[model samples]
Target: MTLNWDNCPAVSRSSDVMSGAVVFAGTRVPVSALFENIEGGATIDDFLSWFEGVTKEQVNEVLEFATSSLAPA
Candidate 1:
């Protein structure tokens, strides 16, 4: 299923912090944390295990949003 920013929970910019390679948007969890886990052979279930507040759908949305934002014209 395709996920978009509109359907996902809002991650407030004010609560986010960018430090070098990491982006932390509230939750005190780096946005990369999700990707890192995935890259390390972790499943969605594993990621959710580490982040109880964020759902599988939200993770997909975050990835979708980030992908679009970073896409080249």
Candidate 2:
């Protein structure tokens, strides 16, 4: 199921940004990048080191949002 990212404050989408792909707030880094990097054997620290604008708290919030989405509720 496609997630409703609107409730996640760590991210935003705008026609003016990356063609409206959902990205971390205040940064052009797509949220998908987080998953991709992790899938590619990269740690969160590695991602944070590579992407300067995104913060650990933002990443945590996004993760929390995704995890909550998958809950049995």
Candidate 3:
């Protein structure tokens, strides 16, 4: 199954914003930042504190979406 990224309200990308970079909705922070920071040992709380506008709920939903997408069909 194809993952419908458009259904993810937590993320958005447009040429008008950050040159079409995939970012958390309402924030300039890229989605990749979350993965990169976590890989660098930054916890969810730390990430939330660092980037305002992105809520825990959005992060949780995004993570869940990604996890589900990676699961075996």
Candidate 4:
């Protein structure tokens, strides 16, 4: 199922930002970048280092949101 990011506080989207791509709050970095980096064997720390505008707390929240979305009801 497609995840709805509307309720996730760690991210936001706007017509002015990345052409409305869901990105980490206040940054131009797309949330998809996290998964892409992970799929490419990059660690969380590596992602953070690469995207300085994103915070660890934001990452944690985003990850938690994704996990909770998949949890059995």
Q: Residue-wise lDDT of candidate 1 within 1-73, one digit each (tens)?
A: 3223333353433323544333333454656688788899998888888876776666776777777766876
The parts of candidate 3 lying over 4 Å away from their true place are: 1-4
**TM-score per model over all chains:** 0.58, 0.96, 0.90, 0.94
Please report, in order, the local distance difference test score of every candidate based on alpha carbons.
0.61, 0.97, 0.89, 0.96
TM-score between candidate 1 and the true structure? 0.58
Using TM-score as the measure, which candidate wins? 2
* Candidate 1 segments whose C-alpha is farther than 4 A from its true place: 1-9, 13-26
Ranking by lDDT: 2, 4, 3, 1
Give the per-residue Cα lDDT of candidate 4 at 54. 99
Candidate 4 lDDT tens digits, 1-73: 7789999999999999999999999999999999899999999999999998999999999999999998999
Q: Judge candidate 3 at residue 59 and give its lDDT.
A: 92
The better-scoring model by TM-score among 1 and 2 is 2
Clashing pairs in 3: none
